[model samples]
Target chain A: MSYKDKKVITIGVVRDLTGLSERQIRYYEERKLIFPERTPGGSRKYSFADVELLVEIANKIEDGVQTHEIRKEMLRAQKKQNQEDVRRKMIQGQLNAQFGLRKGPTS
Target chain B: MSYKDKKVITIGVVRDLTGLSERQIRYYEERKLIFPERTPGGSRKYSFADVELLVEIANKIEDGVQTHEIRKEMLRAQKKQNQEDVRRKMIQGQLNAQFGLRKGPTS
Candidate 1:
Protein backbone atom coordinates (compact mmCIF):
# COMPACT_ATOMS: atom_id res chain seq x y z
CA MET A 1 0.00 0.00 0.00
CA SER A 2 1.28 3.43 -0.93
CA TYR A 3 1.52 5.83 2.02
CA LYS A 4 2.20 8.75 -0.30
CA ASP A 5 -0.52 11.18 -1.42
CA LYS A 6 -0.76 14.15 -3.79
CA LYS A 7 -2.45 16.81 -1.67
CA VAL A 8 -0.37 18.71 0.87
CA ILE A 9 -2.47 19.92 3.80
CA THR A 10 -1.55 22.34 6.50
CA ILE A 11 -1.92 21.70 10.25
CA GLY A 12 -5.02 23.91 10.23
CA VAL A 13 -6.68 21.62 7.68
CA VAL A 14 -5.84 18.64 9.87
CA ARG A 15 -7.40 20.43 12.85
CA ASP A 16 -10.55 21.07 10.84
CA LEU A 17 -10.79 17.52 9.55
CA THR A 18 -9.83 15.61 12.70
CA GLY A 19 -11.08 18.13 15.32
CA LEU A 20 -7.71 18.01 17.04
CA SER A 21 -6.02 21.02 18.55
CA GLU A 22 -2.72 22.17 17.09
CA ARG A 23 -1.05 21.49 20.41
CA GLN A 24 -2.41 17.97 20.42
CA ILE A 25 -1.32 17.41 16.82
CA ARG A 26 2.17 18.59 17.58
CA TYR A 27 2.18 16.56 20.75
CA TYR A 28 1.20 13.49 18.79
CA GLU A 29 4.15 14.11 16.57
CA GLU A 30 6.30 14.39 19.68
CA ARG A 31 5.02 10.96 20.62
CA LYS A 32 5.82 9.86 17.06
CA LEU A 33 2.31 8.85 16.01
CA ILE A 34 2.08 10.72 12.69
CA PHE A 35 4.95 12.57 11.05
CA PRO A 36 3.87 15.25 8.57
CA GLU A 37 6.37 16.99 6.30
CA ARG A 38 8.23 20.16 7.27
CA THR A 39 8.42 23.43 5.40
CA PRO A 40 11.76 25.23 4.94
CA GLY A 41 10.75 27.53 7.78
CA GLY A 42 10.01 24.43 9.95
CA SER A 43 6.26 24.68 9.62
CA ARG A 44 4.38 21.37 9.49
CA LYS A 45 2.94 20.32 6.16
CA TYR A 46 0.67 17.30 6.23
CA SER A 47 -0.35 14.99 3.43
CA PHE A 48 -3.80 13.47 2.96
CA ALA A 49 -2.50 10.27 4.47
CA ASP A 50 -1.37 12.23 7.51
CA VAL A 51 -4.85 13.62 7.85
CA GLU A 52 -6.31 10.11 7.82
CA LEU A 53 -3.75 8.98 10.37
CA LEU A 54 -4.64 11.85 12.70
CA VAL A 55 -8.27 10.86 12.45
CA GLU A 56 -7.39 7.27 13.22
CA ILE A 57 -5.21 8.31 16.16
CA ALA A 58 -8.02 10.46 17.49
CA ASN A 59 -10.38 7.49 17.30
CA LYS A 60 -7.97 5.32 19.27
CA ILE A 61 -7.44 8.00 21.90
CA GLU A 62 -11.18 8.28 22.32
CA ASP A 63 -11.22 4.52 22.83
CA GLY A 64 -9.16 4.91 26.04
CA VAL A 65 -5.88 3.70 24.63
CA GLN A 66 -2.83 5.46 26.04
CA THR A 67 -0.39 7.53 23.98
CA HIS A 68 2.73 5.34 23.94
CA GLU A 69 0.71 2.14 23.71
CA ILE A 70 -1.01 3.20 20.52
CA ARG A 71 2.32 3.81 18.87
CA LYS A 72 3.63 0.38 19.86
CA GLU A 73 0.54 -1.47 18.63
CA MET A 74 0.45 0.41 15.32
CA LEU A 75 4.12 -0.29 14.69
CA ARG A 76 3.71 -3.92 15.61
CA ALA A 77 0.66 -4.27 13.41
CA GLN A 78 2.45 -2.55 10.55
CA LYS A 79 5.47 -4.80 10.90
CA LYS A 80 3.25 -7.88 10.93
CA GLN A 81 1.42 -6.72 7.83
CA ASN A 82 4.71 -6.00 6.05
CA GLN A 83 5.95 -9.44 6.98
CA GLU A 84 2.78 -11.00 5.59
CA ASP A 85 3.32 -9.19 2.32
CA VAL A 86 6.92 -10.37 2.17
CA ARG A 87 5.86 -13.93 2.87
CA ARG A 88 3.27 -13.84 0.11
CA LYS A 89 5.80 -12.39 -2.33
CA MET A 90 8.35 -15.05 -1.44
CA ILE A 91 5.81 -17.79 -2.08
CA GLN A 92 4.73 -16.21 -5.34
CA GLY A 93 8.35 -15.94 -6.47
CA GLN A 94 8.97 -19.62 -5.72
CA LEU A 95 5.82 -20.68 -7.50
CA ASN A 96 6.79 -18.64 -10.60
CA ALA A 97 10.34 -19.99 -10.58
CA GLN A 98 9.08 -23.60 -10.49
CA PHE A 99 6.30 -23.13 -13.06
CA GLY A 100 8.27 -20.87 -15.44
CA LEU A 101 5.55 -18.23 -15.07
CA ARG A 102 5.49 -15.10 -17.19
CA LYS A 103 3.27 -12.06 -17.30
CA GLY A 104 0.17 -12.34 -19.56
CA PRO A 105 0.95 -16.00 -20.17
CA THR A 106 -1.58 -18.63 -19.10
CA SER A 107 -1.84 -22.17 -20.44
CA MET B 1 -17.60 -9.08 15.75
CA SER B 2 -18.47 -10.84 18.93
CA TYR B 3 -17.33 -8.73 21.88
CA LYS B 4 -18.13 -11.57 24.22
CA ASP B 5 -15.49 -14.00 25.40
CA LYS B 6 -14.89 -16.90 27.77
CA LYS B 7 -12.06 -16.87 30.40
CA VAL B 8 -12.62 -13.93 32.72
CA ILE B 9 -9.25 -12.56 33.86
CA THR B 10 -8.50 -10.54 36.94
CA ILE B 11 -6.81 -7.15 37.13
CA GLY B 12 -3.49 -8.83 37.92
CA VAL B 13 -3.52 -10.77 34.67
CA VAL B 14 -4.42 -7.65 32.73
CA ARG B 15 -1.55 -5.80 34.35
CA ASP B 16 0.87 -8.59 33.54
CA LEU B 17 -0.38 -9.02 29.99
CA THR B 18 -0.55 -5.32 29.19
CA GLY B 19 2.45 -4.09 31.19
CA LEU B 20 0.21 -1.39 32.60
CA SER B 21 0.19 -0.40 36.21
CA GLU B 22 -2.98 -0.91 38.20
CA ARG B 23 -3.42 2.83 38.64
CA GLN B 24 -3.11 3.42 34.92
CA ILE B 25 -5.55 0.64 34.17
CA ARG B 26 -8.10 2.07 36.56
CA TYR B 27 -7.46 5.54 35.24
CA TYR B 28 -8.07 4.28 31.71
CA GLU B 29 -11.39 2.80 32.88
CA GLU B 30 -12.35 6.09 34.49
CA ARG B 31 -11.58 7.73 31.17
CA LYS B 32 -13.92 5.13 29.65
CA LEU B 33 -11.38 3.22 27.58
CA ILE B 34 -12.06 -0.41 28.48
CA PHE B 35 -15.08 -1.52 30.49
CA PRO B 36 -14.68 -4.99 31.86
CA GLU B 37 -17.54 -6.80 33.56
CA ARG B 38 -17.94 -6.16 37.27
CA THR B 39 -18.35 -8.86 39.83
CA PRO B 40 -21.08 -8.69 42.46
CA GLY B 41 -18.55 -7.31 44.89
CA GLY B 42 -17.48 -4.65 42.35
CA SER B 43 -14.21 -6.25 41.29
CA ARG B 44 -13.26 -6.11 37.61
CA LYS B 45 -13.48 -9.24 35.51
CA TYR B 46 -12.02 -8.86 32.05
CA SER B 47 -12.45 -11.01 29.01
CA PHE B 48 -9.77 -11.74 26.42
CA ALA B 49 -11.15 -8.98 24.22
CA ASP B 50 -10.92 -6.48 27.04
CA VAL B 51 -7.30 -7.46 27.64
CA GLU B 52 -6.55 -7.05 23.96
CA LEU B 53 -8.23 -3.64 24.02
CA LEU B 54 -6.10 -2.58 26.96
CA VAL B 55 -3.02 -3.71 25.10
CA GLU B 56 -4.13 -1.72 22.09
CA ILE B 57 -4.76 1.33 24.23
CA ALA B 58 -1.27 1.01 25.62
CA ASN B 59 0.13 0.82 22.10
CA LYS B 60 -1.70 4.02 21.12
CA ILE B 61 -0.43 5.84 24.17
CA GLU B 62 3.11 4.81 23.26
CA ASP B 63 2.50 6.20 19.77
CA GLY B 64 1.88 9.72 21.16
CA VAL B 65 -1.90 10.06 20.77
CA GLN B 66 -3.46 12.01 23.62
CA THR B 67 -6.06 10.54 25.95
CA HIS B 68 -9.26 12.52 25.26
CA GLU B 69 -8.45 12.83 21.58
CA ILE B 70 -8.02 9.09 21.29
CA ARG B 71 -11.40 8.59 22.93
CA LYS B 72 -13.09 10.98 20.53
CA GLU B 73 -11.47 9.43 17.44
CA MET B 74 -12.22 5.87 18.54
CA LEU B 75 -15.85 6.75 19.12
CA ARG B 76 -16.14 8.39 15.73
CA ALA B 77 -14.49 5.41 14.09
CA GLN B 78 -16.77 2.97 15.95
CA LYS B 79 -19.87 4.89 14.97
CA LYS B 80 -18.77 4.90 11.35
CA GLN B 81 -18.05 1.17 11.46
CA ASN B 82 -21.47 0.49 12.97
CA GLN B 83 -23.13 2.57 10.31
CA GLU B 84 -21.26 0.69 7.61
CA ASP B 85 -22.36 -2.60 9.15
CA VAL B 86 -25.97 -1.45 9.24
CA ARG B 87 -25.76 -0.37 5.64
CA ARG B 88 -24.34 -3.74 4.60
CA LYS B 89 -26.99 -5.63 6.52
CA MET B 90 -29.72 -3.49 5.04
CA ILE B 91 -28.44 -4.20 1.54
CA GLN B 92 -28.10 -7.92 2.24
CA GLY B 93 -31.62 -8.07 3.66
CA GLN B 94 -33.03 -6.34 0.61
CA LEU B 95 -31.22 -8.66 -1.77
CA ASN B 96 -32.34 -11.71 0.15
CA ALA B 97 -35.91 -10.46 0.19
CA GLN B 98 -35.90 -9.90 -3.54
CA PHE B 99 -34.15 -13.13 -4.47
CA GLY B 100 -35.52 -15.44 -1.76
CA LEU B 101 -32.13 -16.46 -0.41
CA ARG B 102 -32.07 -19.67 1.63
CA LYS B 103 -29.61 -21.24 3.99
CA GLY B 104 -27.03 -23.58 2.44
CA PRO B 105 -28.53 -23.15 -1.00
CA THR B 106 -26.46 -22.75 -4.15
CA SER B 107 -27.14 -23.65 -7.78
Candidate 2:
Protein backbone atom coordinates (compact mmCIF):
# COMPACT_ATOMS: atom_id res chain seq x y z
CA MET A 1 0.00 0.00 0.00
CA SER A 2 3.09 2.23 0.08
CA TYR A 3 5.43 3.19 -2.72
CA LYS A 4 8.46 4.20 -0.71
CA ASP A 5 11.02 2.43 -2.85
CA LYS A 6 12.73 5.23 -4.74
CA LYS A 7 14.48 4.60 -8.07
CA VAL A 8 13.74 0.87 -8.06
CA ILE A 9 10.77 0.47 -10.42
CA THR A 10 11.78 0.79 -14.04
CA ILE A 11 10.05 3.03 -16.53
CA GLY A 12 9.06 -0.07 -18.45
CA VAL A 13 7.27 -1.40 -15.38
CA VAL A 14 5.62 1.97 -14.89
CA ARG A 15 4.53 1.93 -18.53
CA ASP A 16 3.08 -1.53 -18.07
CA LEU A 17 1.35 -0.64 -14.82
CA THR A 18 -0.06 2.73 -15.89
CA GLY A 19 -0.71 1.94 -19.55
CA LEU A 20 1.38 4.98 -20.39
CA SER A 21 3.99 5.26 -23.09
CA GLU A 22 7.65 5.85 -22.39
CA ARG A 23 7.39 9.07 -24.34
CA GLN A 24 4.42 10.22 -22.28
CA ILE A 25 6.27 9.51 -19.05
CA ARG A 26 9.31 11.36 -20.28
CA TYR A 27 7.13 14.23 -21.40
CA TYR A 28 5.62 14.43 -17.95
CA GLU A 29 9.14 14.62 -16.58
CA GLU A 30 9.93 17.42 -19.01
CA ARG A 31 6.80 19.21 -17.92
CA LYS A 32 8.09 19.09 -14.33
CA LEU A 33 5.22 16.90 -13.28
CA ILE A 34 6.87 13.73 -11.95
CA PHE A 35 10.41 13.45 -10.67
CA PRO A 36 11.75 9.98 -11.30
CA GLU A 37 15.27 9.11 -10.31
CA ARG A 38 17.85 7.85 -12.78
CA THR A 39 19.90 4.70 -12.43
CA PRO A 40 23.66 4.82 -12.19
CA GLY A 41 23.73 3.70 -15.80
CA GLY A 42 21.41 6.62 -16.72
CA SER A 43 18.13 4.75 -17.04
CA ARG A 44 15.07 6.50 -15.66
CA LYS A 45 13.44 4.70 -12.77
CA TYR A 46 10.06 5.30 -11.19
CA SER A 47 8.29 4.48 -7.96
CA PHE A 48 4.70 3.29 -7.50
CA ALA A 49 3.80 6.80 -6.36
CA ASP A 50 5.08 8.10 -9.70
CA VAL A 51 2.98 5.53 -11.52
CA GLU A 52 -0.13 6.59 -9.61
CA LEU A 53 0.69 10.22 -10.30
CA LEU A 54 1.09 9.46 -14.00
CA VAL A 55 -2.31 7.79 -14.10
CA GLU A 56 -3.83 10.82 -12.40
CA ILE A 57 -2.08 13.12 -14.84
CA ALA A 58 -3.25 11.03 -17.76
CA ASN A 59 -6.82 11.11 -16.44
CA LYS A 60 -6.72 14.89 -16.05
CA ILE A 61 -5.23 15.32 -19.52
CA GLU A 62 -7.98 13.14 -20.91
CA ASP A 63 -10.43 15.49 -19.19
CA GLY A 64 -8.72 18.40 -21.05
CA VAL A 65 -6.64 19.65 -18.18
CA GLN A 66 -3.49 21.45 -19.32
CA THR A 67 -0.11 20.19 -18.11
CA HIS A 68 0.62 23.59 -16.55
CA GLU A 69 -2.70 23.47 -14.77
CA ILE A 70 -1.85 20.01 -13.49
CA ARG A 71 1.44 21.35 -12.23
CA LYS A 72 -0.35 24.12 -10.35
CA GLU A 73 -2.79 21.63 -8.92
CA MET A 74 0.08 19.47 -7.75
CA LEU A 75 1.61 22.45 -5.96
CA ARG A 76 -1.68 23.19 -4.26
CA ALA A 77 -2.05 19.59 -3.20
CA GLN A 78 1.50 19.55 -1.85
CA LYS A 79 0.73 22.72 0.15
CA LYS A 80 -2.39 21.12 1.53
CA GLN A 81 -0.53 17.97 2.51
CA ASN A 82 2.11 20.10 4.22
CA GLN A 83 -0.54 21.94 6.19
CA GLU A 84 -2.18 18.69 7.23
CA ASP A 85 1.13 17.32 8.42
CA VAL A 86 1.68 20.44 10.51
CA ARG A 87 -1.79 20.21 11.94
CA ARG A 88 -1.29 16.55 12.84
CA LYS A 89 2.00 17.30 14.56
CA MET A 90 0.44 20.15 16.52
CA ILE A 91 -2.39 17.91 17.66
CA GLN A 92 0.08 15.23 18.64
CA GLY A 93 2.07 17.81 20.58
CA GLN A 94 -1.00 19.06 22.41
CA LEU A 95 -2.03 15.52 23.26
CA ASN A 96 1.42 14.75 24.54
CA ALA A 97 1.40 17.88 26.67
CA GLN A 98 -2.03 17.05 28.04
CA PHE A 99 -0.84 13.56 28.95
CA GLY A 100 2.27 15.06 30.65
CA LEU A 101 4.52 13.19 28.25
CA ARG A 102 8.11 14.25 28.87
CA LYS A 103 9.05 14.00 25.20
CA GLY A 104 6.43 16.47 23.99
CA PRO A 105 7.26 18.79 21.10
CA THR A 106 8.05 21.75 23.34
CA SER A 107 10.13 19.58 25.60
CA MET B 1 9.78 19.21 11.81
CA SER B 2 8.80 17.52 8.56
CA TYR B 3 10.24 18.36 5.10
CA LYS B 4 7.31 17.26 2.99
CA ASP B 5 7.22 20.17 0.55
CA LYS B 6 8.15 18.73 -2.82
CA LYS B 7 9.80 20.89 -5.49
CA VAL B 8 9.17 24.18 -3.78
CA ILE B 9 12.64 25.28 -2.58
CA THR B 10 15.23 26.44 -5.07
CA ILE B 11 18.72 25.00 -5.51
CA GLY B 12 20.25 28.29 -4.36
CA VAL B 13 18.34 28.09 -1.12
CA VAL B 14 19.39 24.47 -0.76
CA ARG B 15 22.99 25.40 -1.38
CA ASP B 16 22.80 28.18 1.19
CA LEU B 17 21.15 25.97 3.78
CA THR B 18 23.36 22.93 3.21
CA GLY B 19 26.62 24.84 2.60
CA LEU B 20 27.09 22.79 -0.55
CA SER B 21 28.17 24.09 -3.93
CA GLU B 22 25.84 23.95 -6.91
CA ARG B 23 28.25 21.67 -8.74
CA GLN B 24 28.34 19.26 -5.82
CA ILE B 25 24.57 19.16 -5.71
CA ARG B 26 24.37 18.57 -9.45
CA TYR B 27 27.08 15.96 -9.18
CA TYR B 28 25.03 14.12 -6.58
CA GLU B 29 22.07 14.22 -8.98
CA GLU B 30 24.32 12.94 -11.74
CA ARG B 31 25.50 10.19 -9.43
CA LYS B 32 21.87 9.24 -9.02
CA LEU B 33 21.98 10.05 -5.36
CA ILE B 34 19.59 13.02 -5.14
CA PHE B 35 16.50 13.56 -7.27
CA PRO B 36 15.50 17.19 -7.49
CA GLU B 37 12.45 18.24 -9.42
CA ARG B 38 12.83 20.65 -12.32
CA THR B 39 10.90 23.82 -12.90
CA PRO B 40 8.74 24.20 -15.99
CA GLY B 41 11.56 26.31 -17.46
CA GLY B 42 14.11 23.58 -16.44
CA SER B 43 15.73 25.02 -13.33
CA ARG B 44 16.32 22.45 -10.61
CA LYS B 45 14.13 22.78 -7.54
CA TYR B 46 14.73 21.00 -4.23
CA SER B 47 12.63 20.34 -1.18
CA PHE B 48 13.89 20.60 2.40
CA ALA B 49 14.14 16.79 2.43
CA ASP B 50 16.42 16.97 -0.61
CA VAL B 51 18.58 19.55 1.13
CA GLU B 52 18.89 17.32 4.17
CA LEU B 53 19.73 14.38 1.95
CA LEU B 54 22.40 16.47 0.22
CA VAL B 55 23.95 17.33 3.54
CA GLU B 56 23.94 13.68 4.56
CA ILE B 57 25.45 12.68 1.21
CA ALA B 58 28.13 15.36 1.58
CA ASN B 59 29.04 14.11 5.01
CA LYS B 60 29.24 10.56 3.77
CA ILE B 61 31.42 11.60 0.81
CA GLU B 62 33.69 13.50 3.17
CA ASP B 63 33.98 10.29 5.15
CA GLY B 64 35.26 8.65 1.93
CA VAL B 65 32.11 6.76 1.05
CA GLN B 66 31.56 6.12 -2.65
CA THR B 67 28.45 7.32 -4.38
CA HIS B 68 27.41 3.80 -5.31
CA GLU B 69 27.70 2.76 -1.69
CA ILE B 70 25.64 5.75 -0.72
CA ARG B 71 23.03 4.69 -3.25
CA LYS B 72 22.91 1.21 -1.79
CA GLU B 73 22.59 2.63 1.70
CA MET B 74 19.74 4.79 0.49
CA LEU B 75 17.95 1.78 -0.91
CA ARG B 76 18.40 -0.04 2.36
CA ALA B 77 17.12 2.91 4.32
CA GLN B 78 14.14 3.24 2.02
CA LYS B 79 13.34 -0.43 2.45
CA LYS B 80 13.52 -0.05 6.20
CA GLN B 81 11.19 2.92 6.05
CA ASN B 82 8.76 0.96 3.91
CA GLN B 83 8.78 -1.90 6.36
CA GLU B 84 8.17 0.53 9.17
CA ASP B 85 5.24 2.00 7.31
CA VAL B 86 3.75 -1.43 6.82
CA ARG B 87 4.24 -2.30 10.46
CA ARG B 88 2.62 0.96 11.51
CA LYS B 89 -0.33 0.31 9.25
CA MET B 90 -0.76 -3.20 10.59
CA ILE B 91 -0.71 -1.88 14.13
CA GLN B 92 -3.26 0.74 13.18
CA GLY B 93 -5.43 -1.94 11.67
CA GLN B 94 -5.26 -4.03 14.80
CA LEU B 95 -6.09 -1.03 16.97
CA ASN B 96 -9.02 -0.18 14.75
CA ALA B 97 -10.32 -3.72 14.95
CA GLN B 98 -10.02 -3.70 18.74
CA PHE B 99 -11.95 -0.42 18.87
CA GLY B 100 -14.62 -1.71 16.49
CA LEU B 101 -13.69 0.94 13.96
CA ARG B 102 -15.51 0.25 10.71
CA LYS B 103 -12.79 1.67 8.48
CA GLY B 104 -9.97 -0.72 9.27
CA PRO B 105 -7.48 -1.65 6.61
CA THR B 106 -9.30 -4.84 5.74
CA SER B 107 -12.67 -3.17 5.86
State which candidate has the highest lDDT.
2
lDDT of 2 at B58: 94
Residue B30 in model 1: shift from native, Å? 0.4
lDDT of each: 0.76, 0.79
The TM-score between candidate 1 and the true structure equals 0.45
Cα error of candidate 1 at position B78, Å: 0.4
Residue-wise C-alpha lDDT for candidate 2, range A1-107, written one tens digit per residue: 33244444556556766898999999999999999876556777666567778999999999999999999999999999999999999998898779855754863
Query: Cα deviation of A13 in candidate 1 (Å)?
Result: 50
The pairs that clash in candidate 2 are: none
TM-score of chain A of each: 0.78, 0.83
Give the Å shift of residue B54 in candidate 2. 30
Tens digits of per-residue lDDT for model 1, A1-97:
3323522445655676578999999999999998776655666766557777888888899999888999999899999999999999999899888
For residues B25-83, could you state the per-residue lDDT of candidate 2 as single tens digits?
99999999988876556778676578778889999999999999999999999999999
TM-score of candidate 2 relative to the true fold: 0.46
lDDT of model number 2: 0.79
Instruction: Output DockQ, candidate 2.
Output: 0.03
